[model samples]
Target: MTQDEKGQLKALLRDEPSMRLHRELEKELRDDMMQRLLTVRPDDPAFAALTQFHRGCLHGLHELWGRREQFVKQPIQGGNDDK
Candidate 1:
């Protein structure tokens, strides 16, 4: 993994807010997969959770990304460490 990804993951592991974030994130990921299938119909009332979960995931990612610099690193080449 890139340092940025590693750092972000580490931070996420250490952080609580992101814990909740991922729950929504997971729901969102699942929702995306279901959305297409759901689209074929007018939509079931029970599926509201999917829409809410997906929206919440987007909200979390947007907020978390703002603080990403705390963990994210600048991109560098594999052979440029000496520079």
Candidate 2:
């Protein structure tokens, strides 16, 4: 992701309560997806779709949290004030 995008995410996560709520929601979604996956057989028509959706969710969350970690450790850069 671009630095600007990372900065935006950092801004979004800076609110402690919002961040906590986001994490809680992420966990709930993960748990619910896992339960849904349990209902599908490998050969079922919807299994592929469900698994893909699950993978996408995991990948997205991974990216988001990874960026969050980075921003937490590093200071955000100031935008171009001289422009």
Candidate 3:
């Protein structure tokens, strides 16, 4: 994670309004991904890869949504130390 991402995560953890905004963004991204998935033709050469990418995104979103509290309690490991 970049420092900016770490900061954003912290904000999301510490502020209810930040988290609500993050949720709205996530919902928008999910809707866009679903629209893309719907428009893909099964016969297209990229179909499998495209669907797999969206599936991975969906899984990640689900994981994040379910783990917000856990994330709030622990710092994500890959970001540059902000302290």
Candidate 4:
């Protein structure tokens, strides 16, 4: 993450309002992904490629969400490490 992004994340971790907003954002993203996945047709030629792309997108989103949750759960100490 960039230094500015890291600083913003730290600020979010320390602020309840920002944390709540993050949770809401995550929920919205997940819901939107689900909607898009549901719209994909299994018989379409593009199905396989689209499915693969969606899977990767969801996986990345989940990973980032998990990381954010972990960051918020733990106390913010000065560190560059993501995990």
Candidate 5:
């Protein structure tokens, strides 16, 4: 190849705007893929275990929250308060 053509090719490769565009495209693709994955619901048979596990965890959290609310609403009385 001619030196002029080689210089032009090198300059094109080193262009900052093109490099930034490539990075932006890759980041956009990765974010789009992540959003698609998040949109999918795991109700398939293969995900039954995971679904059940999450459901159980949510139920446990709700139960704990209810208990905490009750405890907060009814403050504990000290044992010596009945004197």
Candidate 6:
């Protein structure tokens, strides 16, 4: 990720509860993937597919997090300031 992407992720993590949950879930999934991959043989195609799937999942989670952050930062309706 670029520095700007990193900054956006940090901001999202600060303001969005769902983003925090996503990051925690992603960390757990990554750890589980690592453990499962360790049991697979090097030549196994399933192992490669699993790794690729996790990569895609992480990428999607990051994109969602960025969008959610932008959403949360937007002004609320009725001219509310409490949000």
| Cα RMSD to the true fold for all candidates | 10.6, 8.2, 8.3, 9.6, 24.8, 8.5
Clashes in candidate 3: how many?
0
For candidate 1, give the lDDT of residue 14: 57
lDDT of 1 by residue, 1-83 (tens): 79997876777655888667767776767678486547744477656765676667677776766666554445344885675
Writing each residue's lDDT as its tens digit, candidate 5 over 1-83 gives 59997676667655788667656755665565455556656766535655455556556655654464345445788887685
10 residues in a row with least lDDT, candidate 4: 65-74
Q: Please give each candidate's TM-score.
A: 0.37, 0.48, 0.51, 0.40, 0.46, 0.58
Candidate 1 TM-score over all chains jointly: 0.37
lDDT of 4: 0.70
Ranking by lDDT: 2, 6, 3, 4, 1, 5
Please identify model 6 stretches exceeding 4 Å from their true place: 1-13, 16-19, 70-83
In terms of lDDT, the poorest run of 10 residues in model 6 is 72-81
| Model 4 error, position 66 (Å) | 9.2
Instruction: For residue 15, give model 5's deviation from the true position in Å.
Output: 0.6
- Residues 1-83 of candidate 2 have per-residue lDDT tens digits of 79998787777777788678778968887898889979999899898998788788878876876677666657777877666
Q: Between candidates 2 and 5, name the one with more favorable TM-score.
A: 2
| C-alpha local distance difference test of each model | 0.66, 0.79, 0.76, 0.70, 0.60, 0.77
> Best TM-score goes to which candidate?
6
Tens-place lDDT digits, model 3, residues 1-83? 79998887777666888567767877877787778868878898677887788778778877876788676767568766666
User: For model 6, what is the C-alpha lDDT against the true structure?
Assistant: 0.77
Pairs in clash, predicted candidate 3: none
Error of 5 at 17 (Å): 0.5
